[model samples]
Target: MAENDSFHHVLRGLGPQVEHRGEVIVIGLGRFGSSLGRTLVDMGHEVLGLDLDEQRVAEHSDSLTHVAEVDTTNVKALRQLGVGDATTVVVCIGADVESSVLTTAAVADLEVPNIWAKAMTEPHGRILARVGAHNVVFPEAEMGSRVAHLVTGGLLEYVALDDDFALVEMVAPDAIVGVPLGESNLRADHRVTIVCVKPSESGFTYADRDTVLDPSDIVVVAGHRSDLERFADR
Candidate 1:
């Protein structure tokens, strides 16, 4: 087997085992939070949902293990609802940044093991991270980035590693056809690595120096944003 194949084989042999069996608390009953809680329930996890709207609580009662009409930002209410000891708490209040921050901090003060929050902007995202949130998500901006990739037809998938770096996977344009990985020296020349070169018919083959590019092949590369932007014909 090739080196990359052996690497993937070893990774596949490792199992992802769940280490805890506690309830999950989800604050906010809006579109994002409600859907997330429902997915967790479908996965056989005990989910407790909290929202200020009584109507929402009633509407989703059947889908949740427990539902409460409580102001999630209120520390007393959050604690009374048993949110502090939840295995994980996800704060999905996007409409109000203050409320999201308050609830996220409340969960952290309560010592919840995992806290996930949604932020409205770059600053908000950074604040959430600094305040001890395990993960801060920018849903709107992220979706917009994905949409931009789709609009640019040559672009397949673009995953941001940081503000300036991205890993892009795309169908190699006609200009780069027939070039071998070694000759392109994507890593040395462009500071990008062609990790996976997947033919139209096969799933994927780990790219190597000798790997030849085909017109129908899809290449998954990790590198700076500038290189991928230029390669995508952007």
Candidate 2:
């Protein structure tokens, strides 16, 4: 077998045999984990954060519902801490690929319904998925791409719907101003869709045919990345 395949084969049985149960479990307490755990708490979901570091556990104790310094690599430690009961589990271990994979496998062994893991590279992400992670996120890579778009364009906000599709928020360009949106032919001329708009006086609302926009008005446009970039360049 290939070297990489052999490595995965050895990791396959690393998770301890354990039966199910947890609400929302977050493993690792680094920057990403802390941010994600706090956000989940802010959103009203109880999160159980597990980390091997005592200092980290103490640091985030107040931010999340529960924070513990438990060896996440051990299935018994996790189960004893109630991690097996998690309905949703997000492993945010960054840098340490071994712990990340092992912890994820352990979570998967528990048969958690939803598993989200953070991966630094494609290979790392693949291992995470192979170990049964339901979702894998590349936070740093995604953010880097997003920041690249922001720095290169006039976009106020950019959200990628997928590799090729994007939603952009930007100021009304001079070319599209001084006319009702319906008469502007933006769809035909710019090949973008105006889903919503925020005029100088109000909050964002669904844009309509009769919507007339002034310069500096914020507009939310959705389309392929290339089309949005081209329109933004205008």
Candidate 3:
């Protein structure tokens, strides 16, 4: 696999698993939307992708379960495309704030059980939320933060759980290398908990207090954002 695909695979593995197997409708076939649809399909879920741009629709036709060129802002178009039947609808028209908002509103009016939208800015996210989006994502900002964490050196990956908490994958700190987790006192000292450890060899295992940290091991840690930053800096 390509490096980007490998990275995405690792990231997905680190996230919580979903048990639901249902149809998903993704509106706006941009990079984010297309990736989401493809991932959902890879996870054994049926996906319907829609976009205003015929070129975009054509590009993903072979990859997605279904693809259609339709204006998501039109309630009639969405209904005709069976958007109301989807288990979830994701609006991912980040470049066009107007279209994104309108599409989200249209989906909301349909009262889809799950509605997710991507916003380009804080105000755009607020607008999407106001329009009844169950979740709003600021992809650019989130990516920037992830990159910043990696640039700090020991951190391999970072995922924000919320404004205050984060989950980070990083190399075992030198101070804790070769020490039993119980003796490391990371939780008491740094207010962080090691949830999983990935050895240099292969798969990850749940971390236990008796688990010994190898110098080459990568550990997934969860804690408040500030505490995580401090732990990483150490």
What does candidate 3's lDDT look like per residue over 1-234, in tens digits?
Answer: 775443333322222233344788889888999999999999888899999999999999999999999988999989888887675888989998899999999998887877778888867776777787777777788899889988965788998876678899998988778988999889789899999999999789999978998889999999998898888887
Worst 10 residues of 1 by lDDT: 9-18
What are the models' TM-scores?
0.74, 0.89, 0.87
Give model 3's TM-score versus the native structure: 0.87
Ranking of all candidate structures by their TM-score, best first: 2, 3, 1
Taking the tens digit of each residue's C-alpha lDDT, what string does model 1 give over 129-211? Answer: 55657777777878798778668657778777665677778887665579877887566656667788899888988988888
Clashing pairs in 2: 21-84, 21-85, 21-86, 22-85, 22-86, 22-87, 23-86
Off by over 4 Å in 2: 1-22
Model 1: residues >4 Å from true position, as ranges? Answer: 1-21, 38-46, 58-66, 122-134, 149-153
The predicted structure with the larger TM-score, 1 or 2, is: 2
In terms of lDDT, the poorest run of 10 residues in model 2 is 9-18
| C-alpha lDDT values of all predictions | 0.77, 0.85, 0.83
Model 2, range 85-183, lDDT digits (tens) per residue?
777788999799999999999988887777778889878987887898877788988899899999999998998876688899999888888898899
RMSD of each: 8.9, 5.8, 7.9
